[model samples]
Target chain A: MSIRARIDALFPRLASEQQFPTQGQTIFVDLERQEVRRAWIPHRVVTQLLGGRGVNMFLLHNLLDEALEPIHPEVPLIFGTGILTSMVPSASRGNVTSWSPESRVLMDSNAGDYFPSFMKLNGIDHLVLYGKAPKWTLLHFEGDQPKFVDAAPFMGLDNIDLRAKIANDFSGVEGKDYGLAAITTAGENLVLCSGIMAGPKAIYARGGPGAKMGALNLKAVLIQGRSADLSTARPHKLRNRDVAVKLLNTSVVKNALKKRGTPFLYKPSRMLGAMGTKNNQETTWTDKLDAENIDPYRPGMEGCFACPVNCRPLNDMSVLGESGVGSRESETPAVDHVAATPDTRQPTPIPDKYVKGDGPEYVTLGKFGPNVGITEVTQVLRLNNICNDLGLDTASTGSAISWAMELYQRGMITREQTQIDLEWGNYETIERLLFMTAKREGFGDVIADSSQAVATGKYPRESLDYLMAVKGLTQSDPHDARILKAFALGLAVATRGMDHLRNRVTLEINAKINDSPDFKAELYGGPVSAEPNSYEGKETAVRRCENIYAVGDSVGMCRFTTKLFNSPSLPGYEEFADQVANVTGIELTNEAIDHIGLNVMGVERLINAKLGITRADDTLPKRWFEEAIGVGPYKGEKIDRGEFDKMLSRFYAISNLTEEGVPKPEWREELEGVLTA
Target chain B: MLQTESRVTVRLPEPLREGRGDVITMNATSLGDIIAELDLADDRDELFNFAVNGDLVLHGEKDVALKYGDEVEIVVAFAGG
Candidate 1:
């Protein structure tokens, strides 16, 4: 098809004011029947839901049947691009939505880079799959035409090798490069904690979407298309430059991200007495994992497509041991310190050549480092690399391992149950457990689904109190929330369980914002919203943070590029509306945008309600309230139950939900109208 | 009036280092005094969250008194990841 013909075919309902397709066509695939279908994203839905995560939630709420199992053939698996995707800078996000096989709740995992943009270039906004393939299959779209090929040869390959092999095979095919969303050996083996590898550094690395894809017998989704031509979008030169300049000048972007990537946050986190240490029994540890110490391991930095802030670090594997700076030859003694046993495990050979990969983000660093009692930066990097290549969610994997280690420390779990001695900071044992978990081998099956799975029936009732999880999903944020009321509340009530990407009020730490009471009231509905430890105004803060984050996720904007992450000068709700107007000629007031965010939350609640989640599930783990933080400047800090309950009630009232945390019937009916229309 | 001689080591974030190393020694009785001594007390509330010997001292608690050889870390509020 000609380019114009293809565009017309894909976006039949394209609006006149739109210089380019804003919300492109939806492609539905029936893997069982090998059938393909297409439809335009209705204008009404676009206006209300605003595509990406919002539209994904809308579609899933209307189409998904809760009776079906998470990996059932009839269950819908959806991938969608945000409305602003490919039309603006740092807006390359694509969302993968489905019922999580791990968390057993509605899950939306998002990432950025070439994949979403490539999907748009091929004239697709959302791709929904139903039913299962007969065998392991690769779904390849060659310039908007779909093909199914045998994927037998690609099975069991690690993520890096898998991408390389596919690229090598498709190297000279009409000189077109392919965009891949693939899984590795972990997913192929149906590991419950596996994630979908989207790009070099972007992974849909939560909620086990990879296992769902594996269950569908879908090995990979590949898109081959011509490079995107920027002229059609008619991007404003001065506005783009202005945004670029603002980002470049931001102190956090310049000093923290541009210097050492996300891992730089590790020191601050430790200093705040917030970093979760030794399975959260403490909040600080050895300073060996400090950002300055890890400087030599970082070769350079990179960024997502069109993102000026290159927050991703390229870690050099060559600088990990005896040959590198700050090498700890004495620390590598082949003996288990806790068990006092000779370490019989053989060391994996380091590559002689210089090797590099993206990672050791703050979450991964903390989860693998202090939380598990492994203070060595090299060990954390090694574990992170293994997870990336094996298609495992690093946060969940680290949480599970740490929980087991704590159990072992208490003499609750013996070597007989674990088969291997579960000692704190034993890198070899941790490594072995990771492999075993990915393959679901032997005792690995007991804990592969995360600590929630391990606690139920397998462990004693008291053990349930110690598993730091909400609604089956383990907490991903490394910062201890007990001292920070806002963070604590956010973790308790986030839609996708304990993950911070959902609704964290990160600005609570900024003492300067507290001085501007007017701004605080406008954003968070109260004058005193910025205090971290205060119960006053916390409910409003959490509610407002969730709403704005909903807008960010829906518009395909990175949280790092917005006020949601750090910089106050970046785009907020008002600026976002302006951006939408500039890109698509869609004039929406900031209030309307905020309403859209509220509607997104409503739709998500409806979906979760169907899955039997309610106010009871919106609570912190027992440990947060029962046990005070044993160490830290914030010693004796614990969540006050009465205060937390009052906060929840206030949040529910503001969200137009009932005291039970369910959306009222009228709001639900209104949201249902948006979904069905 | 008798005066207390308080000596402490202060650690600052990269940007706030200002050609000085990450760690610097100062003699001050309180966090406010330290901030003033370092010439950082002017309109820099957002840039700091002070901690003395790993204990958090909030904006309201800047009057938190210091002692001899206390290690103070000027923790930045914004942790980007």
Candidate 2:
């Protein structure tokens, strides 16, 4: 078959439907040459590498001709969706793919928002960009046709203002008619912590994709209009989505999310005495920062597109609405707003203009709450509000700030260098630093860089002691690795640097309730080989979770609902295969699904190898091994290096990679052949 | 299959309340007793970790002895946000 013919065949759709199942026409635009060429990814690519991060990896590997920085003009910026996104439940995911200016590796960041469904509904599943814009531009999509409008007016605007100005321009169209992605000034300044915003809330908030867009001088991708010729799909595949919907309706655990938001993490982690506080140095906190504390402010429960579970807490942060700099069009907005904003909400004395807020999820709570020693729930909301406006990633920003706070306490970074009398848990100082960091002013400029770079520049060698990072990225998920052994292992081996989204072992030595041999065999497909504290069976558990998560990311499904081992009713690899087969007319058995995941994994390993990542990089931070958690039930707890090595070796063996974390020649050859694009 | 005549106040988070109320007075001595008393026995998903006065009952049944007025917080287990 011809490449286009193969691409057509891969996405099987309903004959009754007039549109392509993959949605959107494929086109490549070179900004420098001002050329827009029609292009299509042979469906063979999706079959070989799957979609989302997997497909992104394969395409980027083949496209890059020379070793250029992520912000280099020659690099391509790619946006992709999974085969199942907008076709199935909770698949409201859109991914941005590029070499990360932060980690300097080909990376993809996924966000759940209205924007992705707009792409799917509009038939623009895959969009690619090249060269640098001669002038700032906004790529507006009406179906597949894009008009590159001058974006000079939108330049230097915060994420919220950019979204609002554009949304207001098209306000007559209604809220659901369009989806937009834009950047803040931080991205324009090339701040390593910057991210791409989708809608006013959801963010592709990791790996500095914003910096790449900023370098392109591309302001936005505004997608509007439905596919006049809608993509068709086999009704049988879509009918299978009922399985997920029914499961969602009946599941008991899904209710927890609906009721409490991600704040559910607070109660359990606190009960185990394993919550993050004052960075990783402490993992316990006072009861005031508990998940339940948000009760007064949490008004409504919201959800992503097509999802039944409304897991996000809609907070009436109107008090905080005026607290942001987004309201002002030009110049620094916060210094004025900070003084002008006032609190009408009483009891806790939270200051105003930062309200009408959306989230203070677990990461926000942990990072801004316990991690920084602020027990006040409202202050965390302030942090969330600030980060959301300035286009900063809450996880990394929190980690970076907390890491610095730890340094200051130990007398490593004094006030002379920091320009603030930095102290642990000082909410006022913490809030001040957030503004400065976002603006890249004063000491904030030093911190806007990677924590490792900051440590190298400002602190002594011993200062690396408490920096909980892997592969130069700060640890975002606030879990202390010493307590959640498998999570720690996931951070080390995951393709993304220091991320837990790739894999999480729900059952582990730490949570050893499922230790029976029969039960282990039933769930894990193996014998009860190791205890929670032992290194024996952890590798098997982590590898299994990673592949399932890999498939979830590729399909654009939410992993919280799909692969959760904590639940009695998680959709497994078999279910994933069934959905893929039903939706795309691709018949994938359980083995094929596993193979696809492995194929994706192998490609990432190859890419990382090409980027010079090694087995040593596939290791945890010194904090996990050297410093025992100072407080908590798991006090004086640290990972055993010997045990960690055993687990790492097991992981390498499973991935078909060498001990040095590089894919073996045969493995590379197999992946290379799979990259038929 | 032990005699259960003890009384305990089991506090349920909103998700598990079945629209009754957050606080429930049930006859229970052990974790199994609480599960059975709530009539959650047949549908017992073991969905939560039992905590008595902020410490987890690592062992499920009767691991931590219940006392009068001791607040039991049922926490749902999750990996990340």
Candidate 3:
């Protein structure tokens, strides 16, 4: 049957009281028309897509114009719920999409729990918002209608307070649970680095979606549904839910993430000299590892929604307060310490009592710590809290700060002229600057615009050469490019600029080998191991990983669990295709799924191209090639431009791009065809 | 003839214990010679700044003579911001 016919048939059947189950209901609000419309997306489609990430991406690519810049007001903002969100057991991952302010590219960030399942119960496969609301308005979905309520009271509220207020207001609602995904003061102010917060702790914090929303004057998107029919799937469909539960409960998938979160992987990465430190100047910080209390292994495990793998850590902040340490996560403290304490002779010991909380993930630490040279645990916490409250992305904030510090160090700006004293390890100046950047105060205002912009006149253009970013997004995880060429290439070509999440080639390669002879061969370049330093098969490896990630994102599944758990084989695809076939009744093939991934990537590339991005935006910081650290596994090593160029050529070849690295006209035509059709 | 060997006591951070054996002792004519003999990774060097007795050693000028029982501390540099 045609997709349109299938959807038409299912919508009526699911919407009608006779055929519709009691657990679900449809609520529709048309803001522009000031009318209410309602419909249901079949449970079959939800099951097939496996919820949030997968379904959302599919809708987004279809709804938004691929050629438009990610930040354009015309770009659509999509909120989607996953198949197993509330019903099946495991972490519940919610997905959001927008043009990323940080990367200046297309991107999405995930939130945990309530939001996904709650939306699903309301009979929404996805919430698609296009164009800007005329004014600040609160979108409230209840029963079969969406109420456009006044949002003036909630306007300007920070994420934490906003969530508290929403929960308080909706406290009386029973099984009809709800959650708020809103922007903070920084986002409302349209700060370039702002992010959207979901609930108290979970945040869709990357890519500056908050800033995008603020620009459009979108106050908050509140998803609340009381329909009990959401859990009432058909008896036969219950079998699929059981399969999902078994898959999640199985030992293989949950063990890895549960052990030490994803941060544990850093041990091997560090040993291989692939860990990032101080904006990629140093690959490892062995001594600081203990002082900064950067442990891959820790106690307590938390998760999102029905996800069984509890990867989030519940941190203790009491010790941190006692030690005069404001922040107690892993990365921020490390970044602050390394950047501030440049001269090693007076090695300062971070007080053990000050170590508070759990993660400063690899990216957070790399950006916040060595990158900007401040080492106080308190200072990192302050920065983290400030960023959260201000609605700025911690990664971008750290990157920008590091860039400013380097510019100052290089004589690009005098200490007095820069306004803030950027001496390494000084908490006072760093603290002042964090708020300043959020408020666009003084030099902070100029720096918050972007590293590229700051590097323009604040520092000599040559000094900008040291920034390790692609487009405007800073590179996360300080792995040496020479050691992990595939990762470097992936970062360079990432759709949302330089990020580790989008194309995790390094982790994928590591997982594939898995303590076997095969692993050795891949790493060492022999039957035993492939040489990590060699770029020989890196392009192919990166391309495969990128494609898989894109597919996962478009399918609306959590990459953390889905990609890692179902490696080598994507178990859910057949079911996923079946679900799409049943709902839209479009017989989607595995090949079609692959096509969606590629198509999304192509669209992302088009978006960048429209923004006038070229090969220049794909390059890394020049310091990686020029500065050779005096010690460590990579002591004498540095990236050579010629070799990088060769690698880029190979990468372009795999993507079927022209020699100059532009997507081939034929490929573009093919993508355009798919889009139009 | 062996010049007076510096009795440098290297303190290992708790986290690095797994990588390097808990404690190591080495003899060298100068601090540079000791560093060369130890064959530590560059990341380790970035982590700790060496102090002889209580004075900081400047890079490149490795001529500080090591005397018997001369205390050397390998202090780990903190990076938390």
Candidate 4:
């Protein structure tokens, strides 16, 4: 039998006494052709690949003819959720994927909120959007059938307004009746940093997949499914369901999440000096961004669909700013502006109390604050809200603006070219620049396109290093590799580029909090050190973390939960595999689940490998390698080039790849069925 | 287990105070020893993540030696993407 046939044969029958939804189907919509088709994903493929990101990538790799230009109308964009999504214990995540306009590479982003569960409830596991909509279009699913409505009326509206409008159109519906995923005018204009916003403050905001959606003229997607919730299948799995339930019910993280939300990170991150200051010229700061400082403005906290860990904190900056009437804690920023007026010259000063949303997550906090030299938490909240309204990836947007400020300070760009004084920590210029970037106006246009902004032809060679990006994605998860070797390695080698979540070594990071060399040794399967800067055995730890996280992400669980990568004592294979068995009615061993993770990452690596990604791409920016971090305990620390190369080779080995970072031929050959399917 | 002889000073974050004063005393020698003795309720023992003077006893260290100084700073440890 062919390798594909053998793989399929292994999963021919459910590996349990109970049964699963083996007939999950795909909804294929051709926007350009204005047609739709439905097909069932073979049961074996579903079982082997699992779902969410893994399944989406599996289908996308097979369906593509060639790599489309990032904004090409024919780019296949997959919006998908997994088998156990919204089942319980923080599993309400969905993933979106396409060729990233930002990095010009294979792209995928995951978000936790309302959309994933609805997709599952609607019996729609995946939506492979093909071709382009001839006009502005809305894909609305009320039941099993989807209605393609004209999005003209909602065109040019920000994500929040557009979603509210769509929700209003489906009035008198139950509270859980529907969820929306939308793009703003930035997306409409094909801005590289545009992101799709879902739920309240939940955004799939990476890699400019939103631009792909807008390029197809697709606007809002309002989704609702009428099936019973996943509770129907919750009684089948053996062992530890009660223990899992108990952990979810009484976890301190969940309790703290209910109270402080993510805002709790504000002080600790700063205190540890694990922060990016002034675009990484410094990695620590003394500023007014502590939890005590911002608590008065915090009204409440929220959780995503079915999540008991209500960890999203609401930041009410409107109380401190222009206090607009619509600045209610739950509102998505502005209500005064419905459809955007297209005159770019008119600057919209952030109105009093204009910012009302949840979370100044460490991402937004790090990128917008000390990284860009803005210390005021109030402005960071407003900036975060503006990014939401304008449909910007806060990471990319903040990095781009910070990149520009560094150039301005160094006199790389004259005031004549900028038409404004580009100074660090200047809120006025920063605020105006944000609006302009969304509108793609003037200096904002230059700043918005960061890759173009720093191309050697446009600037000096030194400027490229200062951009603080790896593989074209800018940095700021507040992790500094100069002090944290694993962080540096992760930034260099993460498939998504410069992100900590993908493969960040979290297991040993907390070792310094007390001193658990024994547990650290157990986790690493070798003698382990508590030092963050130690290069010894970091690759093995990173690889282990990558595999665990890969499994968790594919299965639609949040990293912050009691799943794979949070605290060590939370649920791991025993609970997660059991939960899957209960929900899908297919028994899974711990090893089987781990194999799925390894298989999924191998597939993802090959997809990028086909894009010519290699060890050359698996590297940190020039600054991390050449410049020593200015402050913190490991001051003047930098990743030695030889050390990094050794780390990369070890990581590649762990991932079962060539030294160049390509998947071995056997793994690629195994995917021959998927490639040709 | 609160041995008055070898008692080490403990400094807890506000959320982990759990009715104990900010600066309390622990008789245990390691974070795990002290943590294992605390209640398994939502807020009490669950938040014993790290110790300042203990060098580095991070999540699930279960046993890392702690020494008495001015205080061994302990913080509520959590991580996110």
Query: How well does chain A score by TM in each candidate?
Result: 0.91, 0.90, 0.78, 0.89
Measured by TM-score, the strongest candidate is 1
Better of 1 and 2 by TM-score: 1
Least well predicted 10-residue stretch by lDDT in candidate 3 chain A: A337-346
* Ranking of candidates on DockQ, top first: 1, 2, 4, 3
Candidate 2 C-alpha lDDT tens digits along A441-465 = 8877766775544434756777666
Clashes of each: 0, 23, 83, 19
What is candidate 2's CA lDDT for residue A7? 29
Q: What's model 3's lDDT at A349?
A: 34
After superposing candidate 4, which stretches have Cα over 4 Å from the reference?
A1-19, A172-175, A228-246, A249-252, A318-353, A455-462, A512-514, A524-527, A562-564, A674-677, B1-11, B21-73
TM-score of 3: 0.72
The residue-by-residue lDDT of candidate 3 on A367-462, one tens digit each, is 555556655434554455445555667777777776677667767778787766776555556666766666666777766666545533555667
DockQ of each: 0.42, 0.36, 0.03, 0.21
All models: lDDT? Answer: 0.74, 0.69, 0.55, 0.68
lDDT score, candidate 3: 0.55
- CA error at residue A77 for candidate 3, angstroms: 2.8
lDDT tens digits by residue: candidate 1, A1-677: 32223333434443333234344667777787788877766667777878889988877876677877787866777898877776666677888999888888887888876677667667677888777889888899875678988999898887777887888787732213656788777787777788888876678877888888888888888889843343433345556666667666766677677777777667767876778887788887777888888788888988776677778887886754421111232345543322222232335333421145688788889998999888777677767776777788888888888888888899888988878877887777776677778888765665576754643466766776667788778888788889888888888888888888788877677554554567667657666554677788887888878888888888887777765566566666765676677666677888888889888888888888899999999999887888887776667889999999998898899899998777888988788777764
Q: What digit string (tens of lDDT, one per residue) describes model 3 on residues B37-78?
A: 655423211223345654433222145567666666554321
* Candidate 3 segments exceeding 4 Å error: A1-72, A81-91, A172-176, A226-256, A265-272, A286-299, A319-359, A376-382, A455-463, A478-480, A508-529, A564-592, A656-670, B1-81
Candidate 4 at residue A199, lDDT?
Answer: 69
lDDT for A649 in candidate 1 is 90
Docking class of 2: acceptable
> After TM-score superposition, what is the CA distance of residue A549 in candidate 2 from its true location, in Å?
0.9
